[model samples]
Target chain A: NAGVTQTPKFRILKIGQSMTLQCAQDMNHNYMYWYRQDPGMGLKLIYYSVGAGITDKGEVPNGYNVSRSTTEDFPLRLELAAPSQTSVYFCASSLSGGDTEAFFGQGTRLTVV
Target chain B: TQLLEQSPQFLSIQEGENLTVYCNSSSVFSSLQWYRQEPGEGPVLLVTVVTGGEVKKLKRLTFQFGDARKDSSLHITAAQPGDTGLYLCAGGRNNLFFGTGTRLTVIP
Candidate 1:
């Protein structure tokens, strides 16, 4: 089913640069999320989408933006990358929000200098 | 903010040894989930405990949700090198709140 897929497994960006982290899921999930994992820390949610055209902020949503134009895609945009943004980013999806197991992507390792 | 804290941030054990990791929180959860993440990969679901005091097993791994629904424990029996990875506990309400993760390394 390909489950969840993220593009550009690894990337490095300069300060003030911008880019988009692409995520797509084939599972037909209604809930999608973007999370970043710092060293020795748990995954922190950046943004999430309940369905197409419906988005919300999560625990750590600063310095990032997200848009859900279709049911299968939710992309996170970094307008001006900063060194603090260096971390591993993961995309996940689930059939519903609560009490459901989420399927995660392989993760994208991003480094901002 | 609903936070989940994991104990024994890191563990190094020899083969065939036993180990236990904990996750605690001050707020109640409707359900809790456990996931294992290997190097260079995202976390994979291990199990989910929905009811208070519930116990579920996956082969050599045992998971128990506290009766108060605010804590959980994961125990591994006769650990093997293949068991080495980062363990994370997530509490679910309207959304899932992840714990700081317990890193386990089992040496051969």
Candidate 2:
């Protein structure tokens, strides 16, 4: 299994620009999450989905959105990107939430100028 | 939101030395796990401890969960350069919460 996969290993966006960070998992996990990590920091949840058609905001979900239309896909959208959004984003999935092993993508390094 | 705090945020040691990293939280967790991450890469799971006061060992690394279920520790013996990386501890049954992480560097 490819496990979890994220598109565009790196990207740079201008202020007010919008883009989507694509994430997909082949493990058929029920839980998918989007997290951002600043330089020398821990992961902060942006959004998460428990299952298809169910998405919820996390600690830092102000400038982002997420959609889970299929069991294998969960994409994160960045609207009106700002410089503060510059960070490394990671997509992860697990069979279920809580105490389960999560498989993570290599990460998408995003820079908003 | 539950918070997990890790101590000794940074450490550097000579090869073959031993070290321990701690993770503490005011909130209790059903389970806790340890993960190691390298530069430009995502974290990889090292181990998981669920039972209070549980201890698990893998090769030169040992992991323990606090008896109160509010803390955890990771110990590495005979550390090597390969063990040099960012170690993170996460807990929570509803959502995964991560600690700030401990950066370890082993010099040969």
Candidate 3:
């Protein structure tokens, strides 16, 4: 089974352009997260969803939005693509919050020009 | 407030050398995890350490959780070129907080 899947493995955007990154999981996990990794930097949490219709911000939430309408899907939206936002974005899912292993998707490499 | 910090942000060594990476935090966690990520890919889970003072070994890699559950370390013995990558340590909170990450390059 495909544990977690993300679309548009790579993308290039211009300033002020917008796009959505799609993420889906087949494991039926109740928790999903969005994170961004800068060059030689650690992954920073952007947003998280505990379950359907529940979303919360993490450390870095600016310039991004997320919605979880179904348990299997969580999409992250970039409203205004900026060069600073250019990084590798990752989608992850976990059965629950604490002390649980997270399954991660390959990731989306986005570049803002 | 970044809760986790890793040392030796960049490390380069020759094959068969030994190296250690450290992760430190002021917050106590229930568990800690280690992950390795290749270029252009998401991080992959290497191992998880639970319980204070727990130690786990996988092949030539060894992971240790501090007795107070506030820190951890990863040691690689006789490292190979395949071990070159970004190593990240995560602490178990409501969700995992990844460390600054250690970039390791093993030269052959």
Candidate 4:
């Protein structure tokens, strides 16, 4: 069973280019999150959705946006990619929020040039 | 804001040796989880501790939660090369907050 899947395992984006990091889960979970990990740093939350059509900003939400149009999909969009945006992105989902185990995807490695 | 801090940002040890990693926080949590991530991979859950002063064992790894639910520790006995990875601790109340992480390299 595919717990969580992210598309475009690796990508290189030119400055000011826009791209969408696709994330989908088959676990029927209600809680989905987007996080980015920089070298030698912990994962920082970007955006999260508690359910369909309900999204919220996280600690580091600048230069990014997210949409949860369905229960199985939570996509992150970068309107204008910058050098500072290069990082490994992970998508995670949990059965519910708080005190529950989260399942993660393989991750997408994006490099903004 | 809630913060979780992990000690010994990096560690390298010989095989068969033991090591301990710590996670501390000023805010209390309802539960704490440990995860290990290898190169080019997302973090994978190792164990979770809920109750205060709880101790849970996963094979050669022992995880303990502090009595105040604001601290936790992970001890590995007889480390192996396969145990090399970045270990992270996450505390959860209404949301999950991750620690800085400890990078462990068990040299063979």
The two-chain DockQ for each candidate, comma-separated, is 0.70, 0.77, 0.68, 0.66
Task: Output the lDDT of residue B31, model 4.
Answer: 88
DockQ (model 3, Cα)? 0.68
Model 1 Cα shift for residue A100 (angstroms)? 1.0
- Candidate 3 recovers what fraction of true contacts? 0.62
Stretches of model 1 off by over 4 angstroms after superposition: none
lDDT digits (tens) for residues A1-113 of candidate 2: 89999999999999999999999999999999999999888888888888999998878999899999999999999999999999999999999886899999999999998
Q: Is model 1 an incorrect, acceptable, medium or high docking prediction?
A: medium
Estimate, for each residue in B1-108, the C-alpha lDDT of model 4 and write its tens digit: 568999999999999999999999998888899999999888888998999999999999999999999999999999999999999998665456679999999999
Instruction: Mark the regions of model 4 whose C-alpha exceeds 4 Å error after superposition.
Output: none
Candidate 2 A-chain TM-score:
0.98
Q: Per-residue alpha-carbon lDDT of model 1 for B35-105, expressed as tens digits?
A: 99998889999999999999999999999999999999999999999999999998665466689999999
Report how far off residue B12 is in candidate 4 (Å): 0.6
Which 10 successive residues of model 2 chain A have the least lDDT summed? A39-48
* lDDT tens digits by residue: candidate 2, B13-79: 9999999999999998989999999999999999999999999999999999999999999999999
List the candidates ranked by lDDT, beginning with the highest: 2, 1, 3, 4
Model 1, residue pairs in steric clash: none
**Candidate 1 lDDT for residue B61:** 98
What is the Cα-based TM-score of model 3?
0.96
